[model samples]
Target: MIEIACDESGADGENLVGGNTLFFAHGSVDVSVEFAGSVISEIRERIRSPAEEYKANHLLREKHRAVLEWLLGALRGRAHVELVRKESFLVGRVVEVLGGEGAPSGEGVPEEVWGAFVRAGNRLLRVRAEVDSGVLVEEFFGSLDALRSAVAGTEAGEMLARLSGRRERAFAYRASIPTLIPVLDPLFPTIVDTAAHWSSPGTPVHLVHDRQTLLTPARVEWIRQRAEARGVTLAGLRLVQARSDPRVQLADFLAGIARKIAGDEATGVGDPVLGELLRPYLEAGALRGDGARKG
Candidate 1:
């Protein structure tokens, strides 16, 4: 049996956006070239559409299963794939473990808490992966670095940052590939005990700049209405709504709206009304700047 624990860290907010990170450690069993190839293939097929792809399962589930199955197709064997994801603080701690301290912490602590057992489980996987000295793990961390760089200024950064800081806000995992090992050993309790103490207090996702004021309510409303008609949610409409400027770049505005919407969903309020409410300053550049009537 191989245990894999994956984690992501980042922030999601209107301003002060950062990026998200995903880290997972797998048992020595699946740390093979064949398994890595299969997992990559499955993930590529899965992420074809961002709209459809969700972080519902652990990173090493079926996506990694394809490789194992392909390699052991002929023989009748059994292996249990246990996968878990811990984002935000737990992710931060794991990264601290991998890269050392001084990694940036995310904002907002999750309401829930992660005990030592879970931490131990996570670390055990990491230890196994490191001991194996698999080049794939090195590559995985490399890609994570690139992802962080790509979303530095945008909403992507916010979402990434949000996930990195919270302990309870992680995605789900599933042990998709099942194999029969005569004797599967449980991880030592001491490993879990060691990691149980990791914790980072919740911090607010505050904007670096002053909060933008709501200006042209009417024009913002009109654009929001149009955005809604085009299948954009009301909250999404608000992130880019600017009452005074009707000629704003639709693409940039939409991009901002999309990022806010992503975080909004994670925030648990998917209502369109919220977006409509913020329409007045969507294009004003500064929320508190003068409206069309002012200048």
Candidate 2:
């Protein structure tokens, strides 16, 4: 069996609607601790930062361009990342709610249906932090009437019209679970994909993640169950302090860097060369929003 170290950036738990970051990146790496430590050491030699933890920002500086490219080249095939466009994810949840899917968890709709939902949601949604969940829900539903016009005559528009015929249903759904906004945490899918990526039918993989509050005991078990159902051996999953594990720190660097670049792309300010370097490490169904998915 193999062991993979993992970490995530831009995770706001269930606060997908209004969060601090535009993208949530879940990163996993197969490199050994010694190798990861060497990577960290190499960065220190070049950048010479005073921070105890060498994060993605250290490598993202203008003066550290060569250092960042070198690190990406060194980690080329050893790393994997799954990115979520936060606002688009919220749009998917809106579909689940309006489609009468009951709850927004795993694959709430068919592939075609999910695609339609994303297109419709993309037209109306904006990435901004809401003051509270109530405001978030209210503002989302308020935009529905106009969204119909935005995606008029399209398949996504028809789907939204049929599902959201009565806007009251959306609010009622929210009222049922006052605290939970039919949340779908992207980390679950990311972990499952990461497990399948590193492990084959016979070869299991143990995942070590940087500790996250969202990963409760029940949630960890849920991830394992999902992985097993997908025919992957998630033999074990553990949480560790990133400070103690160089492998996890390596994951941190990858996740943070990926999030930054992807965020830039979503905002229309990305560098084409850097995007090319990060393209290979992305997982499936990434950057879903507006009209299509981004690689």
Candidate 3:
């Protein structure tokens, strides 16, 4: 059986607005628990001692960087990691578009529009134009029709016609998950499914999430139902404070590293050492960024 401990960072108001990191581990429960304690102890010691190069404002300071590098190195192949980040403005735009409100003007384009554009071919250029111009929905659809008529005999027109049949129910339903869960929807299932796949067949899975206001009983039930439908047996699902569980603390640091990287990306900065630390998981296809999908 594989035990998974989960935590998140940047979900709270932070450097990267709307940015979040969902990190979890799948491995031997006892071993992970033990290692978590050791990692916590190491971090505490490093915090007590000062390192000259580790400035106060640095997101990935030297001591924190050292601890993360060590933790990630130790977990390299033993545990799987996944990351999902969304630009808040982009997410808000997506919510607005799908929710069918134009009252609030926004700068970013919705993910569905991009998906529709890709699937609908060049005729959808008018839709893109309308969006870029911040046109109202009615005007945008009118432009779409006009473009369709102009390209009626071409291949692009046929693709544009196909876009009309795309099912948007799934995208709309995701909006109901509430709070940060909507942002986390894409990552949760992928990580759970991946962990299930890696575990021995028929072994029961236990999931422990770091406490969050959004993770209410109803939400847990919703997750359970979704997992059941997917054929993944979740033997248990519960929320606990990180301070009460060592494994959860490990998950916190893991998520923190990913969040710092994302914060760096948003601000157009780079940390080579941090990037190097995450390289193995990225190369192994364990850590993934689901930026294009709206949660």
Candidate 4:
């Protein structure tokens, strides 16, 4: 028998970080598990058609539909398909905290965070399911620890702690079963959000400082120029803004560096080439440089 575990992921922010993630797994000891490949193929076809822009949310559902349809069509004549997932109730606190008021939520958090959780939950389910299906799943077992790491949210940690003991039961399986399991990546929305948040104002300046300390010398010179151009006295503004718009920041930063280099050749820091490069960023209201643009 073969076992499968699945997971998925999506973007998280305007900067485009962790967004959507999903995961699940299945296993069976039937050495001649006949329908798995066909089921995966069918799922691939359905998802790819309609030429729709594929988002992270569609994958797991597609897998489910694929498995169910294939089972009913080809294998119903032989094996009784039995599949199981742990029915984890979002605890009252989890629902209250992670989920919002009234209709419920994990809404405020980035979708990728929830995606990681789903991946972890599904991976655990896969281990249990394999045992129930009497399958020896030797591959990818080490991945379970990674799943746990992904889903362990700092903000939601307490709520998750509450879920440890409640109704964490595994399902039983029977003979002649043909199952297809879809697995996906556990998302890292927190990583993206953390980046965005750290770049925002009123955040610790040291965060940016720490990042700046790690930049290459060329990038460092680039930042110095950009900051001088903007007359920005505040620490970390250049780096934070640059992280958001690398291209624009790089151009302006380079312009600033050029002006400085020219200063060594002449008297004061002024150069037509520098002005030309910085003008667009200034006009777009995206950057502020040291001196007003000169003709």
Q: How many collisions per candidate?
A: 39, 0, 0, 26
lDDT of 3 by residue, 98-165 (tens): 44322211124354544332222222211222232223333334544555455566665564455333
Highest TM-score against the true fold, candidate: 2
Residue-level lDDT for 146 in candidate 2: 50
TM-score of 3: 0.58
Model 1 ranges off by over 4 Å: 1-85, 102-132, 151-267, 270-295
For residue 109, model 3's alpha carbon misses the true position, in angstroms, by: 10
Descending-TM-score candidate ranking: 2, 3, 1, 4
In order of appearance, the predictions have TM-scores of: 0.19, 0.80, 0.58, 0.17
- After superposition on all C-alphas, the RMSD of every candidate to the true structure, in Å, is 25.8, 6.6, 9.2, 28.4
Predicted structure 1: lDDT: 0.28
Return the clash pairs for model 3, or none.
none
lDDT: the better of candidates 2 and 4: 2
lDDT of 1 by residue, 1-295 (tens): 1221111112121111122412111111213335434444464464443533223232224454343233223111211111112233334344433433333323332222222222332432232333333343333334344444554776545544543442321111111211121001111111121112111233211101111232135533543454344433333112223222221211122223323433453456643543333333123421211110110
**Model 3 / residue 85 / CA error / Å:** 3.3
Error of 3 at 207 (Å): 1.0
Clash pairs, candidate 2, are none
**Top lDDT model:** 2
Task: Estimate, for each residue in 1-295, the C-alpha lDDT of model 2 and write its tens digit.
Answer: 9999999988876666435788888889999899999998898999998998888988999999999899889999999887777756666666665664322221334544444434334322323333444565555544554555565676656665676565566546544642211255567767777787787779888999999776778778877888898888888889999999999998999999999988888778988888888888885435332321231
